[model samples]
Target: MKIGREDFEAFINGEKSITPYIETDLLAGSYSVFGVKTASNPNYLIKAIYEMYELNLNKKLAVKAVRNLFRSVGLGSVGLNNLLKKLGIDLKPSEFLMLVFKLQHQQGWGAPFELLEATDKRIILRTKQTFESQVMKDWNMQVCGIHQGWIEGVLMAVTGMNWFCLERTCHAKGDEFCEFVADQAESSWKFKAEAIVKGESAITEFIEHKPVEGTIKLIDDPVVIMPRFVFTSMMNSLKKTMGEMPAGGVNYRAYMDMGKENVEHYRKMGITKPHILADMAFTFYSQMGWFRIISMEWNEAKKEKTITLEHTVESEAFGNTGKNVCYCTAGLLAGIVEGSFGIKVQGREIRCRSKGDEHCVFAITNKPE
Candidate 1:
């Protein structure tokens, strides 16, 4: 059966007024046929699951499976463990089936972060700081005020890393920012602040930004707000739908310290200036030469900025950070900074660095509008 766009929209929007059976139909359409049971014989078990549960199982159920028994009743609303306790089922199949039910019934599925793509070198940052930090609050303003894209990046990185809403015990002066009250998704990650000052310069220092000669600007200044909005939406969606990772999964402190220390080391080694740093790092990693600004194409209508130049780079340096980990650290740094700042920094080529020298100076500056 063909599902109309409006019906799909209503289903996704959670308009409880609609018929619940349709949800089951939607799930059956998307996930009913998995292991190939054609006209000869259909997967009755799977069919029972759809008919009994009457829940949408597209991305959610595809991620996991659910049992017909528990979902048939109202037990589906409770936690997997709680539901198991209520049902008094110890079988492995029972537990697995419950997980499947949870996945199918889950309101939203899929990692919101996956939707994020690199545009004009925009990046998503993952930071380690209390969202309430007066410094970070101010830093956020600095980023969003100048570049709107960074707002979403900051929100996602901050909340995804579990630094959104801070508690009273959080160490921000004046309590200027409130703890993050649950947003629509009821996330625990939260913090409040009126301003974003330059955060612990040590960690945030890794963010690098470059000016492209040609920027596609929107006629009504829409591009200016695109990146930040995108980041914000993604983070909010994750907070609401995707719960937190395990306790020890993401060590924000470690990532922050490592990023800071690396940047400081680069600075000490004389990657002090932003322009120079960008030049040298790109050259060393991409093995490309830089020339002074020759020309720029700024597309205000599209909010895209492009810089044109010529240089040589090594192919190996641009490979992934696993086996060909030439510029892993540098590449990661570039991604973090670009994502956080919502800027683009690309290389035309790559080059091998001298022995005992695995670093280069990158120049970054916050150009005040």
Candidate 2:
């Protein structure tokens, strides 16, 4: 089906699913299966993986997740290879590499990644404006794991060879451009591959090397935000359809499950401290414009904590209905407390701005023995 701006808008509005819009046809080898657009915001994609990274604290797992995401994309690239075969473009190793570069640039992955050197055993590639570098500059770590996996996946799919892509330089590490080297030699690559598969930080070896200094203009990407009204409407609609059950039971269960998932995520990301986890949670929500954590107090002795969140737009938008309306927020807070503190805690929205209070207040207390 032909995708248009309306379809994209509908997708954003939660009125349509993206699956039907994905075009399987090779539109002039442009990877325009999603259609010809100048550029697309990757904030949602970045945020999802970043959240997973924060939750698991496992760099390798996060990297592997991104790699797997692209590996699925690489499966589609295999289909593209079949299309090229029919078009009389021979899938020579060099030609396939060029095809990868072309599709990468055409899809606006970077300002056109260039093949610096290619040999029988190794290949070198460079890009001045990689998507990961632009989006993850603040991360201060090599965030090109997706690209590494992607290159390996596509190459492997085409050549049927086990490939290893090492990111030698990353813009996230303050490099001017990103550089990657793909080696076909299994012996040289096996150690890092094994380490990554074992969920260990194999990226340390790549980042330890000095990066070359160069000058390149960075892309000024726009921040994307979900409309406040849309979010409120969705929440209100759920409340209306599900009735009191949603606020009292469903919301808690759903977000608590989300919390459990986040706990696993943060564990993988290697963050165990309650204070750090709480701070990270506040920052994560604040970045998404959920609410500002006005104050937080943790009592290690009592194993209890209180967090004051203010300017909750959700409550403000819906207004005071004479009941605690921030059920989802309350549930999320409960989950965070449980995950971070490693204890059963209940979050109660005792005060709400919707009910003529100064701000939404949540009291998190440990479950009694």
Candidate 3:
């Protein structure tokens, strides 16, 4: 079924029914998919990220970097394949790919998937609309890089070929639809090299080019912003680059710093109670489309707090991989508590959704004596 802005509005207003899978979570804050957490992200995030890249690099490289980032993190819709398997769609490669696309579409990844033509070596695909196009309609730039890279990754995984897809038309640029053409690459290395090369170039450009505004004032963060897919991809890239432990540590530290940065904001609002300040993040991030806070229990006498999150953004796209793939959020929760109380607090992920837990839970406590 097509979900329109009015539908979203009605759903938000409690005037319409929503999928049971996400009704409670959506009320609590955020969305979930097949027991995995997803987000109702805003369309502007694509533009915001594009702006970040554009400020440092040329538009071509900026777009390429975003595309490759998604490409490398491809086909991450976690538990859908298992569901598709029950339908006995595991035989034909093309059928497998199409089914995956269909499921992704249903999950709001994009519009319905239409396969225009398919050959042994090439395939052409089209979608009338995309989540990005809804916001980027007159931007004069093709902004559906996620679709381009996502299709390429899934094709490669299903066909065991180094598939590369190029966008021919994008609704973001006011086209009638978004179209992509995919073909096998000479080698997987050739297919993967683009991201690596462009990434290196982006790094150089980051240092050389003048940056855009460093910060912007906000009344409150947007309720829907970045996708869980992007969050998972970022964790994946860090894992690939720095190895799991270091990646988790670094990612944790960065977000902790980020959370601390909000100290002034909370102080300005005269929110001084650590528990209240720390509790506010759950709502803040929920509005930012991170995940739904399941439970928050605070123990004042012990100077500790524990949080359980049902919509695990960082782990939703990963299947039961048996790894602790979420940490940055833990740091965030802890950082806010520290800043709120102006005390040293440590955050730790006691349980992770990536490790097959039903929820991601963390704890913040006064630093050890």
Candidate 4:
């Protein structure tokens, strides 16, 4: 696992391939996750989710589960394997890692993921402003569990060795830069993205069909793409943090404004017709992987919008929680309607997968005074 002296010489002699092995679809306003298009959410929002899970689960258990959940993110970068093989030159393991980390930086995972040091027993990696750490700077502990797991999975992929990746320091923990250390492992790993939470199963996957249908739209918004699990993990974390409130109240209230703020960009485009506005909103929503709409009813005279979604991610995240938990999504729809239709509306999740309903239903009607 050590970067041999010859490897260092190869790297220093300018024989390294600087070409990145990742592809980001900037025109489509998204990043490709194993060829599946994904949208971005605010980093602080995702940070809060990590805190929520930290609040609920024991530290060790949470770390272990998360490491497993994000393993796929690293393992899916098979492109790097091809890049290395095509070089057709003998390079040391450390050189390969250095190039791969540089590719991660190019792909926007960090400003620059640099190889700090390499020894017979360990390899040290460093980055100052990792997206994960930057968002969690208010905390007293490291928060790049995703990156740690990424290292573990990618190291295994490159070297065909089980490497245990650990965060030695983090910006969230008052460190100058987030640092990760990797050492060979004795095979204590599992591919369990659907780790359980409070006796319920977390969602294992979204977009059952690989390589989601149609080309990702060449939209006009800038995005930061990570694995789909990060979003699901955020929702699952919300369920844990809700604690005593009626299942969905906390989630519903905290994120209601998100939709309203989001719709403003579309609203300013001068699309006045309510149905057109709704269509615009739903297209953005669907592309973000929230749900696949089964039906949409926009009542003009009544000023109500009823939407039924078959693949509700919120319900899937909490698996059989025995009560309606798409309240956050309902609040989102309500806000979207208020902004899109110019009406004050009462929104409700009338059906939810958690309650064993086949389709999740949200009814947005005019709010009574």
Tens digits of per-residue lDDT for model 4, 243-286: 54543666676556777776676656445566556566665576
Q: lDDT tens digits, residues 1-369, model 2?
A: 454446544543457654464454446543333453333446667767856765745554565557656655554568657755665556566557656655455455533567788877687888875777677677777777777777777777787777777788888888877888988755333344334334443232322222244322111112244577764676667768887655456766677668656655655555666766655555555535678789877778866667778877678677776666776677888887788778888888888887778878887787886
* Top candidate (TM-score): 3
The ten-residue window of minimal lDDT in model 3 covers 201-210
Off by over 4 Å in 4: 1-45, 48-63, 87-91, 188-369
In angstroms, give how far residue 161 of model 2 lies from its true place: 0.9
Rank order (by lDDT, best first): 3, 2, 4, 1
lDDT per residue as tens, model 1, 1-369 = 343444433443456322333323354554221121112123354344433332532322211123112222223223433443444543232223223322333322101111122222232222122221332242222111101111222333222321121122212333432222111122210110001011111111122233373343311111221332332343334446644332111222233344444444444544455544433333222211222223334457644334332211211222222221122233333443443334553311122232122322222222234
> What lDDT is obtained when candidate 4 is compared to the true structure?
0.64
TM-score per candidate, chains pooled: 0.16, 0.42, 0.44, 0.41
Q: Write the per-residue lDDT of candidate 3 for residues 141-216, one digit (tens) a residue.
A: 7777677777777776666677778888887787887888888876432223223333322322212222363433
Q: What is the lDDT of candidate 1?
A: 0.28
All predictions: root-mean-square deviation over Cα? 24.1, 16.8, 23.6, 20.4
Write down the TM-score for model 2: 0.42
Q: Which stretches of candidate 2 lie over 4 Å from their true place?
A: 1-41, 185-369
Residue 150 C-alpha lDDT in model 3 = 77
